[model samples]
Target chain A: MSRIEGRFKQLAMQGRTVLIPYIVAGDPAQDVTVPLMHQLVESGADMIELGVAFSDPMAEGPVIQLAHERALASHTSLSSVLTMVQVFRETDATTPVLLMGYANPVMHMGYAAFADAAGAAGVDGLITVDIPPEEVDGINSELQRVGIDNIFLVAPTTPEERIAQIAARASGFIYYVSLKGVTGAGNLDTKEVASRLKLIRKHSDLPVAVGFGIKDAASAAAVATVADGVVVGSALVDTLAQAFAGGGDQAVALGSAGKLLKQIHQGIANAAS
Target chain B: MTRNTEENIFATVPDEQGRYGVYGGKYVSETLMAALAELESVYRMLSVDPDFQRQLDEDLTHYVGRPSPLYEASRWSDNIGGARIFLKREDLNHTGAHKINNTIGQALLAKHMGKKRVIAETGAGQHGVATATIAARLGLECLVFMGEEDIRRQALNVYRMKLLGAEVIPVTSGSRTLTDAMNEAMRDWVTNVDDTFYCIGTVAGPHPYPLLVRDFQCVIGREARAQSLNQVGRLPDALVACVGGGSNAIGLFHPFLEDSEVAMYGVEAGGHGISTDQHAAPLTAGSPGVLHGNRTYLMQDSDGQIMETHSVSAGLDYPGVGPEHSWLKDLGRVNYVVADDDEALRAFHTLTRVEGIMPALETSHALAYAETLAAQMTPQQMIIVNLSGRGDKDIHTVAEIDGIEF
Candidate 1:
């Protein structure tokens, strides 16, 4: 089984919601990413969604967009991101890692080559924000060949028919955008998220992970009630940004990122118990 | 001119799924797929509905001052000493540019779709002014996203949009240009999809947008063709249009795609030159990639990240082109060329001096190309240039370049 699917299955058996922390690779510095991945795992992150920085991150809010700028400014490229993932695999073999970004950078690397490189780097899945199911066949087939999951996002605005369509093509966990806006956008209505997840469950058996509005412990706990996994991006990235602002303190950034991840982890676990 | 009986494959493009020969698919986030599909279905219904056609036609005729004159630039042609040149006077439209054509059609669509708020993105501000104009007339709320740099440069057009009662939001993100403006606009649409109608100004977005914008602007080609038959007695030997997001070019080229003898040229902005990395001539200098909701020729780095594009005119300073332009360039249906900043400026001045017309710097790229192409042909031949907009908004830039404080 792919690493993502296996991780989800294990978490399901344990009655624990998978906690995924998203960090843009090379955000503050190039050397900080691999260590951050290991740190995240130690702090209770079940999987890592490493963002590949693109020049134009259209779906991102200001927080994540600044993170991308910082990553790009550090001379980060897809190849370097893969190298970081490979290094992370050296110490941790069980934690799943998924690359999340836009399509242009992946297309620049060529689909087959990217799939092979990602698989070799021990990457578990990919979530290209702009590539809908209608346009993902080329990359999807390549990822499938490499045993890497091709995860797709199901938005709150997505209709039932499209949810079924996306679910059919998606492997690993399906990312449900918990709100109607960018990554950092607020106003997450639990009732609305629950209703959407119910419809999504009717269409697919894959684990549903909710992202894009689960900012704090309360929000994560609220989502954990109806979701198999929870993803927190902008809030974590914002923490790292604060560290960078506070005199480029890598230790502080790592500590704060871990602290935030642990709080969300406890939130989910506490709600479950 | 040589003619071939090859069957025209250009008539039916962007098939049911919006694939224009491996380009122009709906490469958006899943949140936007349903909205795009709904728009496609609504446009399909209205495109054929008799009442809707009548309403659009009436708007084009009376409201937008359609059938903009096809004026022959005899003096400019005489100065060039070659092919006769005719200008499709899109500059004479109500909003002083070809942008109003698409805005009017989309505003009408928004009204029909029962959308109360309309949004648009602009680089040079002409499109913003046009959208604001239409939204004001239709009594719909309007918001325009413009890059910070463009808002500073095109202050007059920004003021015009404000005078028309539209809110102009300044985008302060990456590159701070048209591309960023588009990114901001997309975020707004995704957030407010229920009541907001995104009236795209160019032919570069996802499926139905490129298709819809092209259909709305095809009045240029349709009129040019009829005028060619009546005034020139035959299709022109060549057609020329500047391609930014390629709306004006597609509008002027779509109707003549089947005409074997009609040569077409799409002039891209070569800010410095295509050899330098400082130009916006993607079709000439860049490669195919997916960006801004479609796969097209993009100015990008080796890693596929979009590169900052440069041009004298903000309207033409975008990294990506329309997917249809990409397909056409590959099929050898249209000759894609470049005009550098200096050449476009020269042509801008030449047109003003010789033809008593001041072309927008974006449109001057086409005129620059036409000047070169016209000089190579005999006087018996004719070339039609799409005067896509007027240069009134660019007077300050020109004055600054000339070291005059205006």
Candidate 2:
């Protein structure tokens, strides 16, 4: 089994919903990323969705867009992001690390080459936001050959036909965009998410992970009840951005980020799985 | 205006999946796939619908002033002293550009789809003004996303869009140019896919957009083809147009693709020069890459990050060209050339003095190449240049360049 699948299975047996916390690989600074990844794991993050910055991040709202900009400003390329993943993998071999971003960067590094590099760097899954199943065959097969799971997003607007299509192509868990808007948008509407998860369950046996508007402990807990996993992205990035920008040193930023992740992790742990 | 027969190999491109020889696809987020599918289905149904065609045809004639004159530039032709030259006056169309052709078509689609709101992205503000004009006429809410830098450069056109009751949102990310505006517009569309229609201004974007926009703008080549036969007693030997996102160039070239004898040239902005890394000449100096939702020729850095592009014309200051243009370049059907800012500016002055017609800087790029191309051919041969837009919107830019403030 893949690292992601194994992690989900372990969490399922423990009757705990998984918490996936995302961070841009080079946000704030490059040197801080590896240490931050270790900190996130220590704070009870079940998985990590490492964002690889692209020049244009269309799916992101203001907060995450700024995070991408910050990451890009540090001269972080896809190659550099892969290197960061390699460093983070040095001590933490069990935690699943999924790379999430747009397609152009991955396309820049040829699919076969990117898959090989990402696999060597210990990336367990990938979530290329712009590439749907229809356009993912080239990269999917390459990733599959390397034993990397291809994760996909199921938006509220996605039809049942497309859901089945995505489900057939998808491995790992399905990321359900909780809102009809970009990341950092508010109003979770857990009731609507519950209904959509039921529909997605009909199409795929894969676990459904809800994302896009889980801001705090309460929101995370609310989604943890309906989802197999909860992905906290823009909210967590926003916290780290503020922490780094407010700055004392690397330790200060990591501490603040760890604090927030722990709170949400506790909320998920306490929720009724 | 007749379409090329099905037997014409060039006539059946972009296949049903919107692939123009592997250069175009719906490389967008899944949040947008359903909407694109719906748009494609509706557009397909309405394209053959008699009532929809009638309405669009009537609007083109009465509202946009179709059959914009094809004027023979005898004096300019004599100055070049090689080939006879003609100008397709797209500058004379309503809203002062060819952008209105696509906007009008898409606004009608918005109405047909029962969308109460329409959004667009613009660089020179011409498309914004055109979209705003149609939105006002159709009683649809209009929103235009423009780069902060573009808003400052094209202030007059921005005011025109505002006067037409469209909300102009200034995008402040990623070099603050047309590419960024497009990115912001995509974000808005993804956020409000249900009630809003994103009326793309050019022959770029994802699948249906390129196909739809090109079809709407094809009236240019169709009209020019008939006019060429009637006025010149034959088809012109060559066709030339400026290519930014390549809508106008593709519009003028699509109907002539099957005419194996007729050659075509697309002039890209060379900025200072392609060698200096400042130009926007994607087809000339760029490599094939995916950008702005389609696989196309793009000006990108080694890391696949889109690079900032520079051009005197805001409309042509883009890092990527339309996917169809990339396909044509690869197929060697059209010659992609470059006209630097200096050459385009000289062409602007030449056309104004020689033909008593001032062309937009974007159009001037084509005029520059047409001059050189005409100079190479015999006087018996003819070249038709697409005057894509008027110079009225560019007067301020010219004045600033001359170090004259008014």
Write down the DockQ of candidate 1: 0.88
**Taking the candidates in order, what DockQ does each have?**
0.88, 0.84
Per-chain TM-score of chain A in candidate 2 equals 0.98
Chain A TM-scores, one per candidate? 0.98, 0.98
Off by over 4 Å in 1: B1-6
TM-score of each: 0.99, 0.99
Spell out the clash pairs found in candidate 2: none
Residues A1-70 of candidate 2: C-alpha lDDT, one tens digit per residue: 9999899989988888989999998997788789999999999899999999989889999998998899
Candidate 1 lDDT over B137-224, as tens digits, reads 9999999999999998899999999999999999999889999999999999988888999999999899899999999999999999
